[model samples]
Target: MTDTLIQTLDVALGERSYDIVIGPGLLGSLSQHIETVSPTARIAIITDETVYELHGQAIEQALAGRQTHIIIRPAGEAQKSLANLEDILDSLFRAGFDRSDLLIAFGGGVIGDLAGFAASIYKRGMPFIQVPTTLLSQVDSSVGGKTAINNQFGKNLIGAFYQPQKVVTDTDLLKTLPARQLKAGYAEVLKYGLLGDPAFFDALEAGLGQDILDLDEAALTKAIHVSCATKAKIVAQDEREGGVRALLNLGHTFGHALELEAGYDGDLLHGEAVSVGMEMAFRFAVEQGLCPVADADRVSAHLAATDMPRISDMTHLLHDPAALLKHMGQDKKNESGHLTLILPRKIGETFIEKRADREAVLRFLTQLRDEA
Candidate 1:
């Protein structure tokens, strides 16, 4: 994982295939990467205020001789809205951007999702690239091409599966990330292990300190590389969450509900909500005798050890069980009006349960509320 030992993982979608470059000092090579896809194209950089402040000059210097238009907006989950998406599209139009121009998403998950969604609809789709600055975006959201914005009803209720031309993940950018943001991002890294690789989970548990929390070069590199590969394989097979892809939502069913309950405010980050929701999923699975109570406890202990939030931490900010259940019903993963959820059978193994009972979920939510 030396600065020079870069890794390139490809998402093989035949005609739409693209490479995800994982390494350090990649922003300087931005123009070189773009030239391969849209040569002679101007760049429209969409970033939040924070990322623009941190990497604006570096990006400018990288695309030094190229024509670039910068659009800086407010940062946070709340910023992912129809209004903001409209603003971004308006900005691109004002710059007279055409089909050949490139849209670069240069922030964390929110900015990436918003900008990519904008790129997807602007003039019937244009090329977009991801320069994910946060650990969460690098390992999960950015790699999957799941662009989205939030609505009054639910999280990601509006979005598109628009792939990016390239994904540049410079792990060095993570060094300046706040400890909470880093820990939040680790939740997604842990998801791969929880969903399909027990050995990977074991490795993470044993090396939680240096490998994960501390962002050790080799460890972090391996985590991002493997996570991207896992996602690429699943997306290649399922593309649009028809079947196997749903397993990736192991914690998201409960997580999205929590996000809606919080009103997409900073009070609960997407990853932290997923961490708590994963804990709830396992605990619920045990309640239904689908998984062992011991297994559920072990998963909770691991997340807790990483300083992640427990279900109780954010439960007080939410409503009653019925209201939360209503939110879960509106998730996009549902089919035929059934409440679908990705539940774990054990560590490194999970399944989709469309038969998940609403009453059962209500009971579980009530139990969690009481404990909280």
Candidate 2:
């Protein structure tokens, strides 16, 4: 018999109430959640090539006992594009999906964002569930109901505020994730700590490792629970990226710009960019005297231990520090011609700011030159 543990998080929206189910072998329970929201109807499960190869058949078999549509795309951030979104729509159309039919985002953050964005626009809106298969998606992207897609303008520039019917995260699926992906996801997991809750940071610092990667059931569940709960609390306060919701973009502005600079062709994953971005945010904070130098060093060391990128590496990516500032100025999180950069006062403590000067920003990026 397969063991399972399910967690139900109430996002606090009365009519739009959702649940986050976490378990050891919860994928098999996908049908149960579907039934909770849907009354034995047709559905489509959208995923990527990587996930499909690892989990497609099992998911299909579990749900094949009923009407189902399984849509697959090439795996990676590149697949979260208009072309793939179009293909997913075509597949849904071919499957005769209607307003009543459901769309299931059945992979990592990329698949969840793409599939959720498609669901948001299909016939205006439809109820879909976030079956996140990655640590990043489960903790941050999947639960917040902020569905978006990247365009030439920027990452997640074009999207919606559509919430999922539910989110089912299976820890068992994570067992197969590559180490790089695991660490990338770990970066987001650590964000919850770096964002709030110092003890969580201590826990991650103590136990997140290679041995823990394959499957430390206790650690994995706690990580998912805390990350989702953090997002859930923030989303409850600001579901539309208005107030504290912007805090969630802690490392994203620089992160997205780096992805665009690299052309988003899987050369650098989203989490990789954010890993470096967080490092930059801290460095910028220290250089601007916004926080203590020791705090900034601590942030970089923790990130390095996780094998994430750093500020010096970023200076190499963009030769012109002015250009990076320009890219950051264009971030969606910005307000009133000011950048909403989330800087760390110390690990386990971060807050959004609109007071840092542009010249100081240059000083920070320039500081990396000396380190490199």
Candidate 3:
């Protein structure tokens, strides 16, 4: 691979800033990158069983001479819990890891969240690198420092704003993803365009969607680069999600509620939920007369082409509007006892509405339930 295939985007958070390197076949050079951050730090790789099986040998070969330990967990959203977090911490402690060692998150979003959370609490804080293997993690979760495990209360409720020392996103790894998984991640890529870049969305709708799903090298690299750049800019501006950062959660409020309702099972992937949530946000906006019906229709049409689940697809599993409303209320973005929702007025225009009315929200959700 030529150097041109690898693209690097920087997340500028002053002293906590790091580089997100996007490319295919970049894993072989991972050790060289980590050495730049911590030349002699021992390595603790946190990955799921499936990923480790597929890519563990490559990782082992990459760090041939280094002192490395591998900690594997079962792969699934349900695995992102306090129990798993505690087990990882205990295992790392037993492995003789300390503050100076590094934790390498080498899987999808779930592993990244779990390992990042563990790194944050272990020894009060430890340096870590994000080797995001999944497209979703590469574009969103891996770049940002927001790491957390899910609790009974909500998703990502028990987490911290901890940045990684470096992020290595090898696009080559994405080739192994199942079609469903790739589509789920594509939802996030589509989100970047929907939230802030209409041109990107236009391109996706115009045929870039197929290129991305097909894993065309140039198209895949470009998509991941732009997505990371968007995320990096947002994280730099609002490290703890106090302002414009809320825009990144455009579809999360509604989507997360649905995920919670589905019990985070294989029934609804995070990105799938977000895809449906984005549609719901636009649909709700149109219903309130806050967004033009044309724009909402366009958004739905583009996402529909990607084959992501629509609100109606999961409506059968969700019959109680009040229950979903309760989950939305638990969103970390809520402020002053009011639910803060990210609503889109157009393709590239979105705003945070902090005074979301609970009764009105319930009414809208009831209408959606009726459609089922």
Compared with the true structure, all predictions reach lDDT values of 0.88, 0.79, 0.91
lDDT of 2: 0.79
For candidate 2, the TM-score is 0.94
lDDT tens digits, residues 1-372, model 1?
Answer: 355558999999888889999988888888888887788558999998889888889899989999999999988999989998999999999999997789999999999999999999999999999999999999999987788999989999899999999999988889888998998899899999999999888888887533668878778888999899999999999888889989888789888898888888798899998898898899999999999888898898887777787786875755488888999999999988999999999998899998799889999898777776
lDDT of 3 by residue, 1-372 (tens): 558889888899999999888898889999899987887648999999889999999999999999999999999998899988999999999999989889999999999999999999999999999999888998888988999989888899999999999999899999899888898899999999999999999999999988999999899999999999999988888999889999999899999999999988778899999999999999999888889999999988887777777887986656989899999999999988998999998888899999987887888899988988
Candidate closest to the true structure, highest TM-score: 3
TM-score of 3: 0.98
Cα error, candidate 2, residue 301 (Å):
1.9
Q: By how many angstroms RMSD does model 3 differ from the true structure?
A: 0.9
User: Which 10 consecutive positions of candidate 2 have the poorest summed lDDT?
Assistant: 206-215
Q: Identify the runs in model 2 with alpha carbons over 4 angstroms from their true place.
A: 1-4, 208-214, 312-315
Stronger candidate by lDDT (2 vs 3)? 3
Residue clash pairs of candidate 1: none
Among all candidates shown, the one with the greatest lDDT: 3
Give the lDDT of residue 54 in candidate 2: 94
TM-score of each: 0.98, 0.94, 0.98
